[model samples]
Target: MRIAMIMNGFPEISEKFLINQVSGLLEAGIDLDIYAAVRPSGSMRHFAAERYGMYDRTRYTRAARSTKTRVLDAPRLILSNFWSNPVAATRALSTKRYATAARNLKTLYFLEAFGKERYDIVHCHFGPNGLTGSFLKDSGIAKALIVTFHGSDINSYPSRHGTNVFRYLYERADLITANTSFTKGKLVANGCPEGKIAILPVGLRMEEYEFPKERVSRDEATLLTVGRLVEKKGHRYLMDALPSLRTRFSALRWRIIGDGPFMNVLRDHAKELGVSEIVSFEGTKNDQDVAAAYMSSTVFVLPSVTATDGDMEGQGLVIQEAQASRLPVVSTLHNGIPDGLLDGRSGILVPEKDSPALADAIGRLLSDKDLRETYGNAGRDFVAETYDIPLLTKRTVDLYESCITS
Candidate 1:
């Protein structure tokens, strides 16, 4: 079978899971070609293409904005990039926002890039970006189209547009996949047919994430959170909880891994709260380092929430990754987290945006050694059974076979 996987970027450190999926498909004896609108340049591009057998669709033209160009025309570029539509570029010019234009441009790019490719299945990784694949499928360019919803795309983009594009994609897609049941339910509530949606949590390379036997434990009880340092991640709320937590557990230390737009704001908040000494903003560690951080920490927390702009956690993969390292998780009932945690079984789930609850969960895990151990063991078992790459890859391959054969 020939499969075409599409996403916004290729070989991104944050999106290694997509690369893993493509690798899995290839290992399963399926011919796979990765398609992306933008790709990194120089040796990185060549290495990624060679490493993953990706076909360089982005090389069709150098029309995309460079850092210098983007800096100069930030506003105009944002507007044009957002509004241009590839499928109906001229038509989208009448629309108000730049997002529409950007979508058009992407669609146009895909239409050109995919014109000569013979793919049995065209699978996209997110919803808004899935628009291109969905359009191609609708236009009879691909034999079948499937989209895997990865949190924010479903929680934010579709809700903002109010267009039936998501529903249309859901209805037309050969299959729809969600990382957790919570996300699947969200999709159903948003009018996607329940029969079409599959609960397929993002898989992890267990071998690569194996808990180290000789991991050195830190002196202070450490709590960790790893992901993009964005508002929706609820890092601010975690920082707010620190002051109260410190009063009770003075030996507590907090480590936030990853960097983003909100880092400075979080840094300021930490200083204002006087917890600067205890909080460590370890900016964007690599995967092995992240696994080591998970091993060293007493507990992992993801106090995610629905941002003001409607952005939310679809399914927190970091929670699973932490659990895979045999660390107990402290998270919220936001989006698909509950589905991932199994509540009282694997980890504790508190109400979203509640620092008190967040603090309490972390404290509980810290105070009770047995409960923490039990939850940690249970979490590792849960990840092994559910999100292991080999098992997940097989299920994904089954879905692809069904889609192509049908």
Candidate 2:
């Protein structure tokens, strides 16, 4: 089957799960193409994108243009692709339906890249992209449409645009996939049809990770957190716990991987809290760099919290990744995180924004070698059984077949 995937950006360090899905599909010999809105803006890169030759298969829209620029280029864009698919070219200009994007000729530019090709399925990663994929279905370019809602798209985006923002996509999409059950509930609350949605948590390439044979000593343990340095990630709360943690464990260290808009703020906060000497900002690292950090670290702590705008963690993919790497985790009980890890089994869960509780959980793991080893082993087993990429990929294909045949 021919498949086309739509996303907002390509090769993002934060969206490794999407790359894993694409790579798994290609490895299974599926004919797939990617259509992205923009290229990578961050310095960090993923190996799978290069290994799978993703760039060669992706088609990116041109950079954003001013109203004057788009008006000037509209005639050339229309004349260039008018003969190839005149119906699509004309349908793309219906301002009544397409709104501002149509008026600005953004749809025409996308049509120029989409060409006249047809696909069996067009899968979009987030809600807004599903609205874009709705255009493909409306223009008769795709046989079916599937949209997957992660976290922010269901909470933060809708919070800004209002809950009914996805009503148009709900009517047009053939199926909707939620990364977690919590996200599914949000979709239902926002008026998505109950029967149209499915829960499909992101999976990991388990074989890529190697569980450490030896545990780090309790006297000199390193705490690690891997994710975008954003407000919702609660990096500051982790820093808040560090000063108290230092009083207990002198040789303790915290290594924060990944970068974002909040990096400078986090660095400044660390200094202000007098934990700069114990904290190290590792910036944005690639997959290999991240895997190595997982191996060297003693505990993985993702202190996720509901941001001011009501955004929360969906699946906490890195929590599973840390478990897959055999590192014991201490994370918050926020949104879908509880569904991702086994509380008190593979990881420990604490309340959001409670620095004292965060410190206690990390201290418990660091002080006890036997408990750490047990949790680490259990975590590896849990992720391998529940989140293997090959198994999830087959299930994804099954969903596609159902959509195509129905």
Candidate 3:
């Protein structure tokens, strides 16, 4: 089936989960086309993007322009495409349904779909993009619309806008997929019908991560966290747990992978805690480097907490990656993190913002080698059984087919 995959940006380094899904869909022999709102700015990207020719498949729109500029350019945009598809060009100018977006020339990009054959299904990765996909369905650019709610879209966006912000999109979407049960509840809270939403977790490519037969034997207490340096990630809590952890272990170190606006804040926090030397803020790394970090680490810790804007974690995709690598995890009981890993079996869960509990969980795994090995082995098995990409991709395909038939 020919599908249109909608996204905010394409080939983002941090969003390896998206790349994994794209790769899986292509492997399943699906004709997929990517429609991105904007192109990614960085040079760094996943190798799979190149291997799978994702860039060639992607149709990128020009970045957002000023409202005045868009208004002035509206006539040209319409005249330029009217000859090719007059009906779609006319529909793109409708202010009744699209209002601001149409006036701002955003709808003109969706009109470009008429230049090619109509899509069978349009699958949007996040809620905001889903709204765009809903427009596509409404405009008859695609037969079906499927929107996947990851994290902030459900938790934080509605807080800024009202719960009814998604009411229109919800009614138009043929299917809605939530990455976790926690995320699914948030959708229902925002007025999405219970029968329409499906709980589909972000999956991992199991074969890529080599499950360790035994825990890494190391003298230094190496704690690894892989995620963007954001408030919700709670990297500060890891710094908070450092002082207490130092008293118990002589050689303790924490390596944080991925980068964001909060890097300097985390650096300052580490300095204030007098654990700057112990905390290493390694910037963004590609999939291969991330896999290497997971295999070499002693314990994985992700202390996720709700953000100031009510944003929380989704399924903790990285948590599954670490578990897949056979590394025991220690994370907070925030949002859908619990669904990503088995508490006390594959990993440990502490209350959000509890540094002592965070340290205790990390220390427990550090102190007991046998327990670490036990958790490590169980983690690999759990991820393989629950979050395998091939199986999940097949389920996604089934969902797409069902939407078309229904």
Candidate 4:
């Protein structure tokens, strides 16, 4: 079967879900094509395409002449299209409310680009872009349309709109997949048909992230967190927990991997907390470097929270990657993290923004060797059983078949 995976951007360093899914489908002998509205910029452009075998299948279109131009013109277009072609702009206005006006201006850009591609199933990630795919399907461009709700799209965008674009997408999609039951529940609550949503956890390659044989035991216990250094990641809470935590475990070292808008703010907070010496911002690391960081650390902690602007952690993919490397994890019971971490079984889950609880969980893991090993082993087993790439790909293919045949 020919499958087209639609995304806002292809080969994005941040959204590895799209990359991993495409790679899995290709490895599974499925004829796959990746369609991105915009390609990567600068040095990242080349790596993004090559990393996912998207060099050939990927298609890029000129959305806007410049970022400034796109920003200024998007809303004007949305208001213009709101009256004439409401169906075309419904998904854009509803799914990406902030960018609805701007995206509405670029509706023709997407319509033309998607019109040129032919596929059996158009499987799109997130809601805004999925809305575009839905529009195409409705326009009779594809046989069937499938959309995957990846966290923020459902939790923040749709929930805030109260059955605007999201409800429309849910009602029109042939199938809807979510990364966690938490997200699926949100969709069901938003008036989406319960029978239509499926929970499909994102998968990672076990071979690529094998447990290191000679794991390092640090004299100063090291704690690691990997992700974009954004507000949703709850880096500030982690830093806040550190002052009290350092009083107990004096030699604790915190290593933050990944970079984002909040990096400077987090660094400043660490300095103000007087624990800057213990904190090391390693910035963003490649997959190999990330895996190595996981192998070297005592525990992986992601104090994720729902951001003020409604940004949230869909499912923490890093927890799975850390677990795959046989490392114990500590994260908050926020969004879809519990589904990925399995609470006490695979990793410890604490309430969001609770530094005391976060500190307590980290301290417990740091002190107990047997508990850490047990959790680490359980996590690895969990990933193998539920998140193996082959298993996930098969399930996705089955979903695609069901969508097309129905």
lDDT of 2 by residue, 252-271 (tens): 99999888889999989988
CA lDDT of every candidate:
0.75, 0.86, 0.84, 0.78
Candidate no. 3 TM-score? 0.93
Put the candidates in lDDT order, highest first: 2, 3, 4, 1
Cα lDDT for residue 303, model 2? 99
TM-score for each prediction?
0.86, 0.93, 0.93, 0.89
Instruction: Score candidate 4 by lDDT.
Output: 0.78
Cα-based RMSD of the predictions, in order?
Answer: 4.9, 2.5, 2.3, 4.0
lDDT of 4 by residue, 350-404 (tens): 9999999999999998888889889988999999898988899999988988887
Model 2 score (lDDT): 0.86
Error of 4 at 299 (Å): 0.6
| Model 2 TM-score, all chains together | 0.93
Worst 10 residues of 3 by lDDT: 211-220
- Model 4 regions more than 4 Å off: 45-52, 65-68, 71-103, 159-162, 215-220
Question: Where's the lowest-lDDT run of ten residues in candidate 2?
Answer: 211-220
Clashes of each: 19, 0, 0, 4
